[model samples]
Target: MPDEHDQDEEPELELTSALVPFFVITNGRALPSDQQYERTALVTALKGTSAAARTLSPEAQAIVDLVAHGFLSVAEVAGHTHLPLGIVRILLAQLEESGLVLVRKPVPRAEPTDRELLGDVLAGLKSKFGA
Candidate 1:
């Protein structure tokens, strides 16, 4: 029943909501100027449900947080942490094996898993100086 144009629209419907990105409630104006606000709010929501993450060893938690964000490469972790590339990659592999971490795709796409969102926020705030 759908045309080719309709089929192309289907994928976007999966991830985007109809709600406008932002609004000035008092002024009754749509203020959806920044995509980053959506990203920030979603990250906050994900973190709300992740109390269990605190139970992880500090280093492991750090690793999880780092990889979950848009910083999706092992080399980024190494550069940020100032750890040797081999050590960082080895730890990442171990985390993956232990079900504590994963390697996300190279490009950050439209949607992210809950864990990814939480990890992104935490990664963005590893330290006051960095954030």
Candidate 2:
């Protein structure tokens, strides 16, 4: 029979990694040191850069891994990592500086659509396709 005292004892708490403060993660800086990263800026791990990720913090490594497969905007990285936008920017700046990742500026918006050009293109496509 199980002892009553044992049943009353609180379940042993599972150990987990302690939370790291944001300040420590970003080395006490609120923003990236050099270039400002827009939330829309795309980031990707450079080819042959995964090796360098080993030298970074776990958070930084996670960022590298997330971008390794394809491009992701700064906002997406923050959401996936559950890290603050500022921290993601700081880490990305460091990774970019270290040549572990590439940060591409968001593409500039195209000038307002020219309806005349669209109509011409549509006419050409229809003629070529006989549709």
Candidate 3:
């Protein structure tokens, strides 16, 4: 006799959530120094190898690489690729929408809650006392 398990079944209950973290988006261009070096090496290798470069459309790949390395801005990528600035902005937006990358913007400060006000006061005191 053989025993069978139904591996095809999946749980259907929906676990709902509304919480979003403050860092839902991060600046993708802030690579550490070591990572930048690694990325540069990889870029050089890709540029040097014809077969490897052919596997990826080098034009698009270059844009992606530079953006990932945080070494190029959308405007810079556009200028290098000879693409329009609007087109570059659109492509960056697409990357963000696809979750392939994140772009950080300054968070607007919220009005102080009681807890936040108290915390700020304590922080001020600590700074004044060099604590």
Q: Which has the greatest TM-score?
A: 2
Tens digits of per-residue lDDT, candidate 2, 1-131, equal 54555565697456686578887887775576434688899999999976667778888999999999999999999999999888899898888889999999987789899999999999999999989
For each candidate, how many residue pairs have backbone atoms clashing (under 3 Å)?
Answer: 0, 0, 1
- The list of candidate 3 runs beyond 4 A from truth reads 1-60, 106-131
Candidate 1 wrong stretches, greater than 4 Å: 1-52, 104-131
The root-mean-square deviation over C-alpha atoms between each candidate and the true structure, in angstroms, is 22.5, 8.9, 17.4
Winner by TM-score between candidate 3 and candidate 2: 2
Scored by lDDT, the top model is 2
> How accurate locally, in lDDT, is each candidate?
0.48, 0.85, 0.46
The collision pairs in model 3 are 29-70
Instruction: Give the clash count for model 3.
Output: 1
Instruction: Give the distance in Å from residue 116's predicted Cα in candidate 3 to where it truly belongs.
Output: 33
Per-model TM-score versus the true fold: 0.36, 0.65, 0.33
* Worst 10 contiguous positions by lDDT, candidate 3: 37-46
